[model samples]
Target chain A: MIRLLAKPVSAVWLLLMLATGLSWWLGLDQGMSSDQQSDYRYISSGLIIIAFIKVRIVIRYFMEVREAPLALKLICDAWLVLVSSAIIYLYCLGPVPVATGG
Target chain B: MTSADCFSAVERKVEIKPHVPGEVGVWVFILGDMLIFGLFFIVFVYYRGLNVELYSHSQATLNQNYGAINTLFLLASSWFVAMAVDDMRNKTVKLAPVFFPLAMLCGLGFGVVKIIEYREKISAGITITSNDFYMYYYIFTGLHFLHVLIGMGVLVFLWRRARFAATQADVRDGAVIEKDMVLIESGASYWHMVDLLWIVLFPLLYLLK
Candidate 1:
């Protein structure tokens, strides 16, 4: 396993899996009653962070953007940062942060 | 073109910047796709912000295990695709032919799993009309599912081309290999985008609170 993780790609994959687990843990309170759960923003921030890390990993390692020219890498990296920030900002704009379905 | 060879030659002599992967056009498409999906993410979050309770309650009704399994499927497939690219880079062209198909199989498996999950949801009378959250869930996952199908099509094309290139590599010069390398790189990049979208979607739709 250590030998496997030595590869940058494999390391990214492992981190992605671990991040997935973290997100899962963050939402495990789904099974608990209402009082047991923390607020959405608190849990979602962690999820968004992991989401950012995972996207960067996929772009850098899997997509081979790490070895690419500066311009290409910058564009992809910018997308990773900005879009996630926008989502988080939108998600935090209001108190309830979600609307009921019609 | 001896682009790959030229890069190596330049590296052996002087230090210059490496070239972009594949064609610039493909990267343009990837960028466009990212913007489109980014818009979707913003829109989903915007809607979710309006009524957190309904969204959270509807989210709870989802089966996290299904989403988790689908995520594993995509991640495993991505590893396979990455390995295929690595195999080609190492001049182990034969290995790419094998790995590419394995990656496709994994992608196909994800579709199968997603279909099953969709069926279960529909049978439970949960659907786009079920709730505000369900509407977004179906729309987002449905659009993503469409991308997966398109990706698989692209993968098939790449597999065929790469396999042919491998055979040509046995007889032709290294340029053949380099030509196919860029193609493989481009296709794999697109496929990774699909996986990347799911990475965020899984947590937001299924795992996060």
Candidate 2:
């Protein structure tokens, strides 16, 4: 029923709001101080992972991938795992240089 | 007269077939589209690694509040479309219009927020040409926004059809149901993809300090 679905949708919105608020609060508390680089990196990484997990839930359940064929579902699941791992790994390793410095 | 009438009624009854086969082609197309986006994602990561400082600097300038809000909007919209698809399957045509617009409105709401964000950023002199960070910021978010717009268009298309088909009788209703479900499912898939991409984009563009 429409009423039933509306509840979950609102709940997800609330969770996202909390996550955003948390990110904003943390970001501001860290201030514009350039000395807090390490703190910023850890906080940003954590937020990214949390957001990733939330998106996965939306895709898997609300998108009805559970009803999709086995192969398609496998592909979808694998894609998320692979992409998330890759991003986290790359983030951990730090950025590459654009070119050789003079 | 009664026996003859019963036999004729049985002979005239039409059989219905499942619409799953036609859906396969569309799914394949969507998968291919996902792969293309996947490649772009990989490239984004590669570049971000090479220019982490610049990218992080660019990200710091992004509005985390807007990014988070848009993420919620897309997530909520995706859920509504899922319900719409479910309602279509259960023969609840009356509910389609309500959920369909709710989904599209969320998508539209995202676009409106994005436009305001873009205007503010541009006024702040942080255009694409501002630096490498701004370049990636614009490219990634702009592409995502374009997909969100397309997803909204798809929902609007389906919503219109559902409205037009609502007045018809049971005989014509079957085809309408099949068409409506197909449209909704396809739109939902695209909408989910939009949400999924944002999940990645949000952290990459906003949270990456």
True contacts kept of each: 0.65, 0.41
Q: What would the TM-score be for candidate 2 when compared with the true structure?
A: 0.79
Candidate 1: segments with Cα more than 4 A from true spot = A1-6, A30-36, A96-102, B1-17
lDDT of 2 by residue, B162-205 (tens): 66545431545456565555666676777777887887777667
lDDT of 1 by residue, A1-102 (tens): 365457889877878877777777775765655443446667778788888888888888888788898998889878888898888787667574433341
Candidate 2 displacement at residue B77 in angstroms: 2.0
Model 1 CA lDDT for position B200: 84
What's the true lDDT of residue A88 in model 2? 69
Q: TM-scores for chain B, in order?
A: 0.88, 0.82
Model 2 spans with C-alpha error above 4 angstroms: A1-39, A95-102, B1-22, B172-175
Top lDDT hit:
1
Q: Please report, in order, the local distance difference test score of every candidate based on alpha carbons.
A: 0.79, 0.69
Show how many residue pairs clash in every candidate, following the order shown.
Answer: 9, 3
Worst 10 residues of 1 chain A by lDDT: A93-102
Interface C-alpha RMSD, model 1 = 1.7
Per-residue alpha-carbon lDDT of model 1 for B1-209, expressed as tens digits? Answer: 58998776443321213766677889899889889988888888788878877887888788887887788788888988887777666553666788788888989999998999899889999989988899989999999999999999988987887687677664544456665677878899999989999988987888656
